[model samples]
Structure formats: structure tokens, C-alpha cells
Target: MEFRRLIRGRVDEPQLERIGREIAKRYDRESVRISVLEADNWLSTPCVVDEEWFVKVISPQNALVQALFTGARNLGVFSRGEEGFFERFEDPLAMSQHELEATRRVREIGLNAPEPIEAFGVDEFGVLVLEYLPEFRTLDELPSTEVEALASELFSALTLMHANNLAHGDLRGENVLVHGGELYFIDATNVRKDGLSTARAYDIACAIATLEPALGANCTVDLAAEHYDAATLLAARDFLDLVRLRPDHEFEATRLKGEIERRAD
Candidate 1:
């Protein structure tokens, strides 16, 4: 937790005030209420604005952390005998711009994502604005039964993204928000087109890893099987352990691996 804080960093009150002012000016609001969310995210300082806009104040530190995570994920891909495919951003605004574009891409392909308002620079921070879902729960926050019920929808969304050649490089459970009874993806990282296949497999690995915790290894593998063939499952299986290394993920990778092998058989 401390390490996460170290990397995630904090936006001081003054910086938040500046961000709020910028947001207010951009939307022609006299003033906006800003409330920082208590989320276990490492990439941005997320907050709600005027109870309407879901905003991310991306700091240079957040961009650096993203670059580090991208590097590490690429190294993991290399372990699978492939070159790295994840792209790195040089600044905070670049990160914000990428997310804005990614969200638009997802929405363009008829998937759920927050309505992207805009991405702009405000001093040292890059701010991204989107429509806020006042009530929602992340995938990891749901009960086992509810999570199981959403299994098909979850995999289907992933399938749509992969089929459209849009790879969600980061598909962690937290990034999958259940809002108004629908799943909305967020925080999609940039990936190279040449690495799309590897990125797709890694996305599937994260999807399976995410479900196994809530639905258990057996059900999770079965759900994956319905959407993906045995070969793809085998490919995703190779990345399971690597996904497990992340601090946010807590699942029995060995059991998941066994289940995937059984499905392949």
C-alpha cells in the first residue's frame, strides 16, 4: 500500500483547486464541486466534478508510473518469446489524450465507456473529462453470484474489443465498472498495432484472472472457453502468471492454469 502511494502520489489541495478552476472555466461553470475518489488506482487522481463529470487529473508522476508498468508488461511479453507491444507516453497530457481517444474508439465500436468530453492541459497536469456514473461497482466489488451472472457479458465485451482490432491493454477488474447494470471499460492503455495479437491474449489472460477470483477457476475457464477456442485459451494461459504478479490481482494462478490445461485437453 505504501509503495502504491509512493508511485501513485497525491495531488495537493492547491493543485486540486487549480484543476477545479480549470474544469470550471472549460465547462462555463461558475464553480464545481470536486471530490477525490478513494480508488486503488495508480495512474491518475480521479475525482467527481459538480456531481456530473468524471475527471482524471493526470500528473507527470502518474505518466512515469504508467511507463514503468508498460515496460514491465512488455518484458513479460518478451518472456513469451515476443517483442514488447505496449506504447509509452512522454507526458501527462499524452496519457490523457490517449485515454480520451481510446474511450472514443470503444464507443465507436458500440461498446460501453464513459462519454469522453475532452482532454486538455492545465499547468503540469493533464485533465480528462467524462460523464460521471453516480452509482456503480467495480467487477471485484460484486458478489460471487452477480459476478457469475455477468460472465457472458464480460467475455462478450472483450470479444468485441478484440474483434475490432482494439486491444485493452489493461483489463483489470477495477477497470471494468458495472454501472446502471452495464459494464463500462476505462483506463485503456495504448498498444502497438503490430503487437495486437499478443496484446489480445494478454487481455484475455487478465479477463480470466479477473473472473477466476469471483467465479472460481472452473467457471472462469468455462466462460472463457465459450468465447475463445482452446488454442487461444492456451495462449492466454501463458500470460496468467505474469498478470498475477501485479499488486492489485489476487488469484490462484496455478489452479487457473490447471483449469486452462484441462479445457485445452
Candidate 2:
């Protein structure tokens, strides 16, 4: 059970093409008309295609593919590979394998992620086809309540992963997407099966630190403290304070604290 095989079950190019064609038909889009939007430039940027889908390509034989598989599952992203594109990359086989595994795992967890449509390792390049989320905004731009709700959902998701011995290596506001008023976890490439407790705590801390500033007055320190551990609450408060001190930061800490205390009374 290699990681790649674990994530992506054995499937050849002809099968992948069939799958892709099926997906295209289902979506009422032409597979041949879909063009390549971008390629990896070592930035790990999520490639956007036709304003309708995102794509991630990989070489079939890469070891990192297994890791990606686990990540995609944890984050709930969809993934598949393209046939006859293996020769397009420096090591198409390895990359294809890695991306396929990642995509497969992401699709497994029932998260709102891109859907994989095809996968195949060939001489030109190993590539993945994924569904794209549209009208999505980053968490940073979302409303405070929406952000907090997303944080709650993300924490709950992490809790479930921790219970099953999984951890999202990188959990941050930037890694979350808000589409149609819902949160979607993206970028699970660094996910692993170790340090579940620590990773869960760290992710909680990251969410608290990241979202505290945008929280409304109704979202008080005490309310947050009620939901999180003492240490995490404190860290969140400290982070909030640091941001408050910055002239450019829009939040008013003194007013928020007073509002919280008033509500407590």
C-alpha cells in the first residue's frame, strides 16, 4: 500500500479520459475546449482554469504524491489526472502520481473541494483535472461573523481529523476560501498523520489569532475564552493587542473589552 496507490487507485489514461469526458458532459462543458491556465513555477499556487475550475498537475512517480493524497482528503478537495500529458514536465510520472494521491485523499473527506475528473501517467506529463469553485473570496475579506463561523467549522474539522490521527500542516486564514457564504479548506499538501494534538492546538491558535481582529464587539474575549483553552485564549488576546497597537489596524480593543465586560454584567 504505497501512499500514491492508497490515495489514487490504479487507473490508466483511457479510463481517465473517459472519466474526464463524463465529467465534461455532466457539467455541459467541452473537455477539448478547456485550456491549461498555468503551470507550477515552484510557487505552489492553485492554478485557475476558465474561471470555472482549478487544476494541479504532478509527476506520477514523485514521493510527495502520497502526502498530497492525505492532505486532499483532510481538506476535502477533489482531484484527478490527465492522460498523454506526462512528457510536459521534468518528471511527469512522479508528479502525476503525487498529485493523484493528493487529489484522491482530499475528495475522500467530504469537504467542499474541487472535484477530480481525470488522472494518468504518460510520456508527456502527469496531470490532474479538478472542479473550480467560483465567486469565492478569501477568509480575510469575509465578514466577521462569517469568519468566526468558519473558524468554528475549521476547528471542528480539525478535531475530527485529530480524532482519526490526521493533521493539516498549514492552517491559516489565507488557506481558507469563502464561497457562497461557506468555508472551504484548501492547500492540504503538508497534511500528515502525526502530532494530532499539537497540530490541532496550533491550528486553533492560528485561527484565533487570525480572526480575533475581525471579530465584532459581540465576539468578546470571555466568549472566546469559553470556547478555547486558557493558553489559546491568552495567545489570542496577545495577538489582538499587538494588532490593536498598530495604527493601521481597524479594531478597537479597549472598546471591545469594555463591551464584553458590560455584557457579562
Candidate 3:
């Protein structure tokens, strides 16, 4: 039951191994190596194996991953389940098909994402291969200028994604990566297509929230106010308001908002 809470369901290692081996054979690789990234925890082991790239394996029993992969793929990202992995939990074939269709749409839009190499699902195994991005830093670790530049770029990308009727559902600090002076979105499993405006605004709020601490005293809300629109500001306000409501987040949000307001003066 505890594992179910973490991974959303049960996962069989043998099933995953079989699928990985099959995929390796299809790609003509010498061996399919399964490295368990996490075990004895709520989350299923996040594994990496030999292929043209890396495959992020999520247990179908995990509600969040399942929802994210399913939702994001529906909005146009490639996601699929491996064969013999988590088959008892859900329909892997349908999820994979939907993810492929989504990936095609995202590709058509020219958004930056890890190239989806292959996807397959059988039995309890489901796997998706994506081009690995090396030498990337999370938004929290970037320099102020780099963060600002990333904000500007994300602004443009978010606008484009919105215009094209897409919403990145989970826009969090860890999900953004900066490499080569460019911002790349990762973990796009929470994307949505229906509520573009709300989704874009939420993403902006999330980005601002993430960038504020890293920007420090030099970067204030007022400084950000100048860069964004009335609607965006409103959204940021709402986000800040929500943060203030949380006991754990109140101090940080208050400080950041004060800095922003001070910068305006």
C-alpha cells in the first residue's frame, strides 16, 4: 500500500528487463543495462540503460507520473510505456499512441525538447527514449543575467506555446534547464491543450516564483513588473498570494514581492 501510494501501482522488474532487452535487440545494441536510480522509496526506481539516448521509466502505479505523461503527451509530447511493464495497471498501448501524436505536434511547433527516439509498451513494461541534454543547470543555479535572459526566452516560448493552444501543467524550478545560453523545458508530462490562457499565466507565475530567489536583491518584483504585462502581473500576484497563504512559503514570497515593489520605486 505504501509503495502504491508512491508509485501509484506495482511494477515488476523482470517485465521491465524483458522489454529493455527487446528494445536493445531492435536497436542492435550489445546489452541493455538497467541502473536503479531509486529503490526502497515511494517512487519507482528511475532507471537508465544503454540506447541511442536515455529512457525515463516510471511505474504505471504512480498517479502523478501517469497523469503527467498522459496529459503532456495529449498536449503533444512523446511518451510511451514499455512492454511487460505495468500492464496490469493500465492500457500502455493507448498511452503510447497518444504520446506519439503529441510528440509530433510539439515537433511541428519547433519547441525545444529532448528528441523522442522511440516508445513501446508491452505487458508490465513501458519505456520512452529521449535525446539526453548534457551540461545543463537548473534555473536555481544560474547567474542573474542568465536567469533574466532565460525568463525573457521562456516568455517568448510560453507565448508561442499558448498561441498554439498548449499549456505546460507543471512549470516548476527543477523542470527548467539552462544550457548554451538557452532555456529548455523538461518533464513536460503536465502539459495541457485546453486552457491556454490559464496555463500560460500559471507557467509565468511559476517561473517568476522560481527566479525570484536566484535573482536576489538586484532583481525585484518591480523590475519584473516592467518586463511583463498587466495580465501577467495579475497572475504573478495571484501566485504570490497563494504562496503567502502557505505557512512554509510566506516568508520567501513576502521578501521577493517586497524587493520587486521596492525596485519599482
Error in Å for residue 113 of model 3: 1.1
Total clashing residue pairs per candidate?
0, 39, 25
The prediction achieving the highest TM-score against the true structure is: 1
Give per-residue CA lDDT, model 3, range 28-125, as digits (tens): 98767766443322223345565236565544554355555434323331121211111112444444444445455555688777667776765644
| Cα error, candidate 2, residue 66 (Å) | 15
* CA-lDDT, candidates in order: 0.89, 0.49, 0.54
Question: Could you tell me the TM-score of candidate 1?
Answer: 0.97
- CA lDDT of 210 in candidate 1? 87
**Following a full C-alpha superposition, what root-mean-square deviation does model 2 have from the true structure?**
12.5
lDDT agreement of model 1 with the native: 0.89
Sort order, TM-score high to low: 1, 3, 2
Model 2, runs deviating above 4 Å: 1-42, 57-103, 118-127, 189-192, 216-227, 231-265
TM-score of 3: 0.68
Cα displacement (angstroms), candidate 1, residue 29, comes to 1.7
- Of candidate 2, the 10-residue stretch with the lowest lDDT total is 78-87
